[model samples]
Target: MRPILRIFLSLTVLLACVMPHAHASVANAPGANLEVALVTYGPGDVYWERFGHDALELRDTVSGEAVNFNYGVFDFNEKNFFLNFARGRMHYLMDAEPTGDEEGYYVQVGRSITRQRLALTPAQAAALRDFLFWNLRPENAGYNYDYYVDNCTTRVRDALDKALGGIIKAHLAAQAGGMSYRQQTDRLMSAQPWLMLLLDLGLGPYADQPMNAWSESFLPYELQANLRRIRVPDGHGGTQPLVQDEQLLSPNRLSVPPAQAPDLRRPLGAAGLAFALLLVATARRARRVHALLATLYLIAAGLAGLLLLVLWTLTSHHSAWANANLLLFSPLAFLLLRTSWRARRGLAPTRFANGVVVLQLLAALAAVLLHLLPGTVQQNQPWILFALPVWLALAWSLRQAAPPASFAGAASARG
Candidate 1:
């Protein structure tokens, strides 16, 4: 009884998580009243295999029947050990159909389905209409082809362009040899005054909703937050029950999900984190190596920060705040080195600590300026930020080259 109850509970939890995804999948479906199933096949390219999810379905509202959409599938050699095993275990709906190709290539029809009985929300219905518009534009040409392998970007772009019907310049195709995708999107939004007006009107928030793995491409976060939901005006100067987000102001968007790694590599971000950890470790050591370790740590952190900043600019066109923070610790770095120098000279840090603080402030400000500089200028050469910590250490060390306060006072009195 206990085991059975546990199994039931687990299945319940699993169903709960999947319900929303399934609902969202149908929200922007292809057809309004008809049961529609759209299937896409993936090209058998290892680099592009992440796009290889099977079929999708939508119910025919008229017939009340479940429709199976056929996506394109890779025709694997039956004799191949992996393909043979996959075929044996893979439960394809079209398994009873002929597997061999009738045309130029070997063929397999992959399956997918969607079925729900509910009135579509206004936003949900609009999304479906947009998708259907695009899907029919190429006469649904590449929908069943294994596009991820051949020309993934072109396939999606053509469909969307066709759907919009008129050359909808309201989009940014990063792969189309323009500025970076994010930058291009921002520029397009800027150019369309109505889009900006819509955004300020609060219709952008609905557009800004985050995309999951399935609907991976759409609006970026900043733009989505701007769209406003509408409250239908009343017939007699009163409101109606209808509520909707500003769809006219939003951009039509689609994005393919990037491939995932089973064994993820250590990202540069992770590397920076680990290097920060090492600096913390060095800070914990004995007095003898404290200054040396701190110096090395400061240098390492500065370089890591610069590398991260460069990568961030390339990928996101914006500098990261944390990367600039690598400079803030330079004052602390200088103080560490100064204390070590004083220890070596058999003197106390108190003798010149005030001078050290002033130098530290300069280092911090230099760091902030470098961090705030525009990417174009900084990208030309990032080594400029590194100089702050190096200079701070050396300058403060030189400035502290004097006798201890107690001895200096005694000497002056005696003289």
Candidate 2:
């Protein structure tokens, strides 16, 4: 009975040793048909889904098995996930799974899926499959995620470029169409006005520069569209289309609603109304109302300026740097709040208060002149238009309020 048990255990060990080689041999067997495709998913309603997603699909015709290589997976429970995300050091990992498992999630979320079958030779298809499997290994799976440069779509593009020995990039360059990063983002995000506003504020001139075909491939849908036009060398001195066939696997039912046009007039009108009230307050010597408005505006502007300062100096957000909006939303506004409160109490105007009013006027003027400068390309006109008149009105109201005679006499003596 012991000899029989030992013989069974030895056979089990032998089978384990032989199984992997057997599977590899079968997978690469001659005459085995293989297909490689790019699977792209349409954007969903969520903020994170606004960019869409893409993956590679490899189908083994002989085994009738379809595998999906996805590079978009990230664990929320990963060490320092949220912290790293804030620091612009988020990590994403590759995930290889059965095609059905991957498709199920996108289908459930109602995002449209499109597949573009690549016209790769058997050797090329095999190489891509091997490369994807190698990349799926734990050591090679993780990558630093950059939204515009090194995200999921770009990963798939780079992988295909690698498999094709730079042929894909060569084709893309030869047939490149120009589009700036900001233009493409704005077009996609046009359905979300608040998001568009935030992005416009956050992104710098780097996003405004024109993108090459390779840079544009960061977008999944753009890659899908460009793949149709790509022509690769056929090894026989002729070119063949990169995409052999294209199919729409699913239609997006959760369409993003169109963005409502920004009402620039409404904000301008509101500012105008506030200015009118400020004029009336100054005329009637309504120190309390004037002080209240000044304090509120100063506090709001101070906070906004501080946030922009942090985004510029303390973070890895490139787009928020060199913001001219700081000129309009000056942090120095906060320093004047004490004087505003003093005025509300009918106290004599201090020299510091007078200086702050002059500084506010100068800041407003600087904001207006910012757009005319060579490198200040931020579209802060709406903010400038809204806040400039309010600053001027506040300045005028402060000047209209006379200081006590005794305080003025003391100030004159000091001067």
Candidate 3:
């Protein structure tokens, strides 16, 4: 299928699911006839859907109708949507639609859907439903969207907590998550190696912090797991499991995120060493060849560093701010690019190029030294062990030799 059609269908399917109907059921008291369930969807084929999604399901048994309330709603046609997304101001809203179409869509897309029937008092259920209704109001639908803190799952989490008189938050707020946000990110993104590696490089210090259970609920799967352990008031002054009963509406047929982040550090280290060796080996048999490879690496790393800098200083992508990878892929490569290009053409690099090379090398060295600091904790081993050696080798190669043909030019230039 064409990419545009796929995205359009995915967005259509994603946005159109969740609950909508709230018609008055005949002979209803509070939520006496309404049933509430937490609906969790598993990962999908696309990258955005890799994090998964969820909604609250409201079923009015008396009326034989149900609605799903999803907070993942966004519009591609909204005014300045792409602009806002780039500014980290993505506008998302709580959306409601009948539940059946959503189920069909997910099943068709090979994503799983699990429903946990929530045991809430009639009052609690009704209050939660009403709050969702209030949230769907035109003025209220727009919400501050942050992937780590206040996305779709977190919204459902907060709404559920409010309905339960804050017990969910009060109970789980103290519990530390099993993994850091970056670790969770890596686990979910493991299926996409290149994307995962890029994120590992771009992510900054904030992604390293351990999320408390409350914050971790931002993940639909985490919230699903955590809720299984929760006991809410049964309205008779006793407690019962938050999930009264569970049902798998549809089994996941697509790839699922691993329980833990994959470890690639060993292979990364090996690859880095091999690449460094390749540079050294080629440096002897082929000067222009070595210079060509060095120029490419320098250009790629330099552009990446400059992009990271833009994200940190000019963009609101907080996760990209303060990226330590900046040290390894320093923008100084751009300054050194000319000299590397010169060497590729059998021309000698200038003395000033040596200073640029030293500065770049020192920056990469600092990245490794950061691990020795008291509180430095960005998990960048893959980047360091993988990319650092390439930079160092290139620096040494630049300083250690000039093409033999450029000897007279080098002498005259020095003279």
Model 1 off-target regions past 4 Å? 1-60, 63-228, 232-289, 312-316, 319-363, 366-415
**Ranked candidates, highest lDDT first:** 3, 2, 1
Q: In model 1, how large is the Cα lDDT of residue 350?
A: 67
- Please provide, for model 3 over 16-127, each residue's C-alpha lDDT reduced to its tens digit, 9 standing for 90 to 100: 2243435544113248888999999998878878899999988888777677778887777778878887767877877766789667778899899999999988888889
Regarding TM-score, does 1 or 3 come out ahead? 3
Ranking by TM-score: 3, 2, 1
**For model 3, which pairs clash?**
18-68, 19-67, 19-68, 19-69, 19-97
lDDT at residue 139 of model 2 (Cα atoms) = 71
Best by TM-score: 3
Lowest-scoring 10 consecutive residues by lDDT in candidate 2?
Answer: 1-10
Q: What TM-score would candidate 1 get against the native?
A: 0.29
lDDT, model 3 = 0.80
Model 3 alpha-carbon miss at residue 188, Å: 1.2
Per lDDT, the best of the predicted structures is 3
